[model samples]
Target: MKQVEVTLNVNGKDTTLTIPPRMTLVDCLRDELRLTGTHVGCEHGICGACSVFLDDEPIRSCLMFAVQAAGHRITTVEGLLNEDGSLSDLQDSFWECHAMQCGYCTPGMLVASESLLAENPDPSEDDIREAISGNLCRCTGYQQIVEAVQMTAKRRREGAANG
Candidate 1:
């Protein structure tokens, strides 16, 4: 079996790994790096459960190969933590708003929401819906998720104004 070396900057850590060419990024993250936050569902990329950040952009890890991720910055849900290692503002908002159920899609939802918030700090309801369209949540009907993002945005704005 032929193997390839790929280097990925994950969660602010530099990691070099050797793996088979056919291995998917999701596999490398979960199997090798032990970042299980990125789930695997609908391996065809429709479920959006395996979403991760490639250079701050939400991408489906299951649809991408490990080799293709080389030299890229990957951020799994584990990376979304405050300096004190507690939940981030967005994560806290999710909890406060009860944005998760079963927790399978939470990670992907977080990634998608983070991407949206990064690009648009003050996202409208429609914007929040469109941002999470790719990630499927059969649990909360998505209303709570949208509310979570909205809450996070509001809190962030307040914090910025006060700080």
Candidate 2:
């Protein structure tokens, strides 16, 4: 099998990998790099289970090729973990808000919402919903996810103001 060497920054670390041209970003992340947090659902970008942060932006990993993201920065659910391996505040908010059920979609939801909060530290409920529009959650009914984003944004803002 032919492979191409690709270099990218993942979770603040430099990564150089060789993958087949046909391999999707999700495959590379999960299979090659062992970042299994990015799920594979539809594999066609509609399900959003393979969502990840590409250079601080939310992108559907299943829709993109691994080589296409070379030199870019990718953030998976593992990246959301704090230095001590504890959950981030946004992660805690997701739990506090009960933003997920079954938890299959939680990682993608966090990637989307975290990217949204990065762009807009204080996001409205509508903004939160719009940010996660591509990601779907069947069990959470969407309300808790929206509230989670809102709550996270509020917490981030408060922290920024205090710090």
Q: What does the lDDT come to for candidate 2? A: 0.88
Each candidate: how many clashes? 0, 0
Give the per-residue lDDT digits (tens) of candidate 2, residues 7-120. 878899988888899999999989999989889998997878889988888899999999998878888999999999999999999999898888888899999888888888
Return the clash pairs for model 1, or none.
none
Name the candidate that leads on TM-score.
1
Taking all chains together, the TM-score of candidate 1 against the true structure is: 0.96
Candidate 1, 1-163: lDDT as tens digits: 8998888889999898999999999999999999988898888899888999998889999999989988889999999988889999999989998888788899999999999999998999999999999999867559888999999999888888999
Q: How much is the lDDT of residue 1 in candidate 1? A: 83
The lDDT for every candidate, in the order shown, is 0.91, 0.88
- Weakest ten-residue segment in model 2 by summed lDDT: 132-141
